[model samples]
Target: MTINKYPIIIISLILLSLNLQAAENYKKFDLPLDLINYMEISLEGKTAVMTVFAGDSSQSFRMESLEDNRSYHEISYQGSVVLNNEGFMSSGAGYPFDLIDKTDVVFDNKKTRILFYQKDPESDVKFRSRKKNNISIFNDINIAGGDFIRGSVVSFWADIVINGEVNEDVIAVYGDISVGQQAVIRGDVISIDGKVDIAKGATVYGRVQASGGKKKFQFDRWTRWHNKEKDFSTIIRFYYDRVDGATPLLGVQFTDEDSLLPNVEIYSGYAFSSEEWRYYVGLEQSFWLKHPITLGGSFYRKLATQDDWLMQRNDNTVFALLATEDYRDYYEAEGGYIFGRFTPLSYFNVEIGTLVEKYTWLDAHTDLWSMFGGSKAFGSNFGSVPAAERASGIEALDGAEMASIILKSDLDNSDREARFGQSFWMGTAELEWLPDGWNDDFDFTRYFVRAGRFQSLNEYSGFYIKAGYGGSDGLLPLHRRYFLGGLETLLGYRHKEYSGQEFWLGNVEYRLTFPKTDITGLLLYNAGQISEEAGKLGDAEVKQSIGIGVSFEESLRLDLSRRLDRSDSSFQIYVRLGINF
Candidate 1:
């Protein structure tokens, strides 16, 4: 070692010089804390351009040359610029391009402050303009594909279409924003007095606000938004049933094209089996008082049922046509009803209505045919149990002129972010009254209360529970009574196997959805009791059933169920559509 001290000293100096030279090839910059998730930076040779977004506010800075060692200055470009690292070389580059590369670079945004590092040269940066890069007023702004904006974009009295990338906030006042599938935004998206429409696969790193698009209270699942952009549309409906056979209806609807006008519908159809003409005319008007209130009225002459809670009409139609299974009893109801619905909160609704109708008993047709169960006859419209064995309250339903008042309320607060399903609690309470001396064949006061809850166990599974009780105070008409059995009720028994003036039912279900698929597996338990006499609900024998099912797209379903309390009972299979609750 003592022989070559001069050479060792010379080598050490050279290595030190190389290390210092490498250090000069990198650059570091501080970013706003709030914009850690809402900022983008691109380098073009010696110039560095950056945009930072904070809620509705955004700022942009441009550095001319890294060799100049100057601070970033504000720029006038409000739109995005395309970023490219092509044509970048380590051999013949000037400032920033000579300093940075694709590798050995890290973007650290998780900290309170963001740090951007650029170090080698396989990645040169380029900014290309497809259009003018600035805010707009009275004219729509469009960002074409492959374009990138380094600053916030603002538009007034117009719309914005983004098919590219935005480095900061995007704001639309009195306008709308439409983000394409491939668009990427590194900042907040804000639409005032309009809607933010995001296509699938679009990415946004900050909050999205649609101030003008509010969720409306849906009266029922059939409620649909009429195309406001169109004048009107025609609707056609068709279904099969034991009483009506094949029923087809045509209708036209007018929506809220003008704020002062109400939504109106008129439809008429013919029932081939019943040989009767059916029609429904309805009008609904909404007003925003202390809360949103809807006033509506309908005049209808058609087949009706009290068992709509068991299955939806669309799902029941499928079962009736394919399986020769009609879970609901039918009656001819010609009536007019006026109702008022109030939404005191986003998740709470109260409705009050009065109806006058002439009721006539319906007889099931023997010629009704099914696809699977060929030539099978439908069951009696009255039910499985004999009228004589039922309570005295089971009065005849034919030729009864009745007037009734109903009050109903429901509360639903559900979590929409669950992966498998929703987690929430929902409850409904209803009371119907037909006071004595109303000059009608029916005189009864009835009440029903039901509650249900869903619990999301994890991303794949959920638990559901529901319970209901219904009872009458006076002579409930035969058609007004409760029936508990197969399908949505106690799956262990036949349809309408049990009937009563008072009844109680409960169900528990666990469901698991397959990852990345619309398929779901279900395990469920159902139990219920029905009493012939009012106030004697628990006196009847309790029937219990356990079932397993699989569903596709949460619609089409196949189920296998068996009685839990009876060993003599065999398994029952069910094919249906839609959710029961």
Candidate 2:
């Protein structure tokens, strides 16, 4: 054998190449038996090779003609037939039925091996019987039971069954996933250019993110002064509440410039109250007809409930229902406007529109028809009676008289334009009394004018001082105006605490802002008066406070104030989440 090793090696190389060429032209075969029964089979040209195996030791088969291509050999087996390192066998091309009842067998082509058995064998079963061999090379190969072309990539497309749990992330970027009914995914899922279809009983433990290249633009300049993208993005937030249960806050917007159309959005939250269940819905839309003109409108509604009515009295009285366990209430409000804007000058713009509003309230055992006085009716007195006499004089005015008074005064002049219209309708003309450069020379100046029985004056332009005489009915409460605190007036005190109907109401503020940071400082002074008549000086109330705070990214603000009126005054804290204007 040593003297002729070269001849034997040359013959083996020729036979190996012939077998590979034969496999290239192999034809597939379909047998009547179940495809899962036989261990493995493959075809090569006119020859079909198969390996049969069984789990029972009593069952066995043999390959009697198995031999190397250079030798004529025969073997008989009562248990198993073990192929030598170099062995070959050939048979007619077709499904092999002769080896179906074999006990155990293996057919290998170096790259992959098919082990036949009646039950699933462990992955390392074949290697356990062999010794000192690297098994990783065989793992790169797969056993194919059906006809598969040699040298072609094999892709498994059937449904994957994972009996246990997968503890790590699973990502699919461009493929479709059809989850089985019993499947469960316990991690986050991110899909791009693909879709995941979860069956009826499937569950996903983490969030699912799905996105596409869809263009969206939102113009929410009014609410989001600092973050322009927030107006255009869609967001969903899940939150758990104490009483009303868990809920999701959603925001969405869309816009189309070619069509000159845009849409507004809203969200759901319990920030408005902590006691009762609450919800809000809002929407707005706008469009441009011409280049210079635009039209828009919006609608919003809020609903809540509370138990007791909280009252605050100043020049007017406000009643708010506070939430309690036994009481429930709801409110709905909706309004819209159609507006047109015109820019007559480069630096100046004007906008005008008509607004319509409707509000409704519902509750258990509540007076929905109760009358509420407005700003215009707060100062109106029916006659010249002292405060004590006027309080008891309600019996003198009948229903018709009260109705006449309300219709003539309150309903007609609550709005600034309406008041001016009423004055013009009564054959009266308003005069403009602007003191030339009132604040240029002195901090204080005076201006006065008369319209019928009404007279008005201003000291230092900032302080509106008024006195009137003429009508026998005495002073109409509408003319007696004063301020407590507001955005434009007292920045130091709460707007609810300020009240007056006559005399002096003035505010002075020194404001400074740091150029390097968002901090703003303010020192303010506020004063006001209330009276039964226009000429009489009412009670004098003065309020002053100092505060400093910072605006967060120009979107939110927090301010703290110390009241100057009292020694033990608690610091008033305010949080504004959005723009004040």
Candidate 3:
């Protein structure tokens, strides 16, 4: 074998010269790994033509193999061609010589690089003999900011980034995809190991799925309609609260649909609320036994100051006794019970529950009570009831007496040294009508009526007519049983001035918006009162206040109001975030 070294060298030199001339006549380009079996590469002028065989077994040329096997032939115009792992087919600037069978090809101006890989022509696998497979696997297709027109079927298991918008019908399978806020995906997105981030203002029209061990999926700042159905089997939130001159609080919440069982939920929290410190611990569970049917129970306990009670007192009392002594007392309330709900239709749901609650004051005094309530929604025919009407309602004599008597009886039986006296029960119901075409043009009108058996006071019934156009910025909660000046309903009036169970409240507001920022300006009028008790309806004094305000940062609001009832009208300012309710 070593005897012909001189002759072999001479033949190689001649073959290399001829090969160099042939290379100069034909151009070359890169080919992807997936298309290696059926791709033919050649060159003509400045254009590179890549013929990909789609019949069956495709043939591909590996640049490294060509260099090694054709050592005798010289490559006059030499360049590297890349063959991707999946072999979808790609090329550099090589002109195509010919195409065989029914195969389609497209040239991308944005992607200027092509790849080439090694292949054996004498192998038993023929180019047109292999069966066609629907799923085309790509080693890696990296689209930085260009368009990738997937022909029939192409799948990838890598990263794909679209700096701009991607048109429709582009299916990409990957471990992860990080889409910028400016990026738009017009087709389906599927991921197995990675998560997706649809940034604020981004849009995705197809379904998105993130399976396997990945977590922490977030959807932020989206503007158009979005539907997200995710299985959050593992998620938790920890919350802590501390305030000056008050108690410190801490709690954790677990939100998993199956944490407990099918249709069953368990929630627990603890906190302390006192003049010096306040705290509470609570737990709740909810279960869905059937469609439109649910059952739930909860237990809670809190240790807080007597001052906290003042916050829950009636607005009329708070305003009247503005200079009351601070009740630095400690109390705890804990209880649990079962409840059931029924929804016969989409617009309406009714719930019934039995709950037993025990309250202990100063760790020595205790009382117990029970509760029951039902809610329903009528069709749109009712002029939508504003938040004010829903919040404020006449306290019916029977309902008020029932609540007061229950608490008083519990305290008497608890062997606690406390005020033992007769109380009242008042039950009131209101019907709000918002006609289909109701608007601010006509003075918004509401009629209220209440009737009940007052234990201490006489059995009574009262009716009132409230009319106003706009007072959405008023301090008072319009829907409350009675309108009283405070941080909510009447901005400029003192909290104690308004007292009693029955009173009329009204507010009218006119809003203006800026053309550039779209911020809103508000002018409002608010007024209302409370009576001495459930029955006696006389000496009804009315207080009117006007306020001017603006809303910015969407919900942050600021308003200034002046009482119009007096000559030296008093004014008050309020700064708040979010809606009143």
Q: What is the lDDT for 303 in model 1?
A: 93
Q: Cα lDDT for residue 151, model 2? A: 12
Local distance difference test values of all predictions, in order = 0.66, 0.30, 0.36
The sequence of per-residue lDDT tens digits that candidate 3 reaches over residues 51-137 is 454346444443423233222222212444332333333344332212111122222332212222222233212322222222233
**Candidate 2 residue 378 C-alpha distance from true site, Å:** 28
CA error at residue 256 for candidate 2, angstroms: 3.2
Better of 1 and 2 by lDDT: 1
For candidate 2, lDDT tens digit of each residue in 1-581? 01233443465456445444543543221121211343443322223334543333222223322222112222223322322112212231222222222211122332122222221222112212212111111012222223221111111111222222322222332233354444344433333234545454443433344222331122232322221122266757543212222334576665432223355555655422222333344333432211223345454433322111111111011111111111112233344445443322222233433433333332222211113312211111222234554443333221111000000010111112112111111111111111223222111111111121111111111111122212212222211123234332344555424433343344443334454554444444444443444445534444565565555544555666666777977766654443321
The best candidate by TM-score is 1
Instruction: Give lDDT: candidate 2, residue 154.
Output: 11
Two-way lDDT contest, 2 vs 3, winner: 3
- Over 1-581, each residue of candidate 1 has an lDDT whose tens digit, in order, gives 01233553465456445434533443322231211233444444345655444445655556574224322221223232222122111122212221211111122331111122231111111111112124555568999999877556666467999999987677775588998878877666766557888776576654566553351121111121221133366979998888888999999987652224688899999999888889999999866422446789999998988888888788888888888888777889999999877665557787778888987766778578889968787876765768674323234566778887777889776523222343567889998776445655776788899998877665577788899999888756777878888877887678788877899999998988888888989998998888988977767788889999898986688989998877888999877776656
> What is the TM-score (0 to 1) of candidate 2?
0.28
Per-candidate total of colliding backbone pairs: 11, 5, 100
Off by over 4 Å in 2: 1-251, 257-259, 262-291, 303-331, 343-349, 361-495, 499-542, 546-581
